[model samples]
Target: METSRKPVLYSYFRSSCSWRVRIALALKGVAYDQAPVNLVKDGGQQLSSEFQSVNPMQQVPALKIDGITLSQSLAIIEYLEETRPDPRILPQDPKKRAQVRMISDHIASGIQPLQNLAVLQQMGEKKMEWAQRCISRGFKALEQTLQETAGRYCVGDEVSMADLCLVPQVYNAERYKVDLAPYPTIRRINKALLELEEFKTSHPSRQPDTPPELKA
Candidate 1:
């Protein structure tokens, strides 16, 4: 972990989960090289034999760091936190840290899976409605949770892992055409998060693999 070598991240731009890791890396000031794994083209490059060898789950947002390949965005982030603690993304206070994990889990597990690519494709004709409804339900709960937990960020005055998780989900919600007016707290938090350089730089449109037309 103390080498001069930069980590390599295999990721896709539109993937919220991938975005989460990207934000974490940026916030930690961990320089990385991106290996764009286009999830859409060629029936998902992530599913290819080579990529699957790197990740049996066949997922993007896999990080090659310190001679280890780590999969799953949140897990990769936790590993980063363990190795690179400066400017920590998790909170120092025990209770606030729990709250951060709570909010992060709610979105990461509760909300994300219901709207992931497989689910969307399975929905077929009802995909739009399914995605919109799923996002609204998740956002409603998230809005309520943040009202009690938020100040400047998801857990408190300082940005935390929860904020990293929230930003990408909000992006996915917007892409799925969910109405944001129902969740003002989420919108406010997202707007503030977007203003920060790390979040802005880690944005999907800014990624190396982002489709040209989708680039902002």
Candidate 2:
């Protein structure tokens, strides 16, 4: 079901979820086009009817590829892993693979969602405080888990889906001004990951739609 047509990613420059997909695409060395969906502009372009048709969830990281459109960052990445296995993101070992999924879920489901833009919008004046609290709590647990599973990357020295989830969540934490001092393992891994070419190029600051003032 492969096609010569390049995949198109619908993304927002500063979106953590979209950034995860960007990292996966870069790591896989898959060339793609971007359809920028300015989440802040025009009262949120993701809410538009046209974009909703692309992803009913109205998410910024919807991927149009292989004659189909896929929503949800992890699912899209898994699809890529299945179709393009070399330079794999998931570990081949069963236990290590389970650990990778566990860490990825810990951040993606347990942490990231709690601080998502829509969730923060609903918190009104309490948004910043709430986001900080959520990230701090999640990072506390993640740090403990990473101490056991991490080896050069999130799972046994190979860059896995967990690493993809970690970098963006850390970005969100910094945006919310959550202190990173307590999460030393997380900070250490993030620093190492940031030095990689794939992570650097996929970073929000370098995105095509990143605001001029925010570009790195």
For residue 210, model 2's alpha carbon misses the true position, in angstroms, by 0.6
Residue 70 local lDDT, model 1: 93
Worst 10 residues of 2 by lDDT: 1-10
Model 1: per-residue Cα lDDT over 167-192, one tens digit each: 99988888888989988889998999
Task: Score each candidate by Cα lDDT.
Answer: 0.90, 0.93
Model 1 stretches astray by more than 4 angstroms:
none
RMSD of candidate 2 to the truth, in angstroms, is 1.0
Q: Which stretches of candidate 2 lie over 4 Å from their true place?
A: none
Output candidate 1 Cα RMSD: 1.0
Q: Candidate 2 residues 168-191, lDDT tens each?
A: 999989988999999989999999
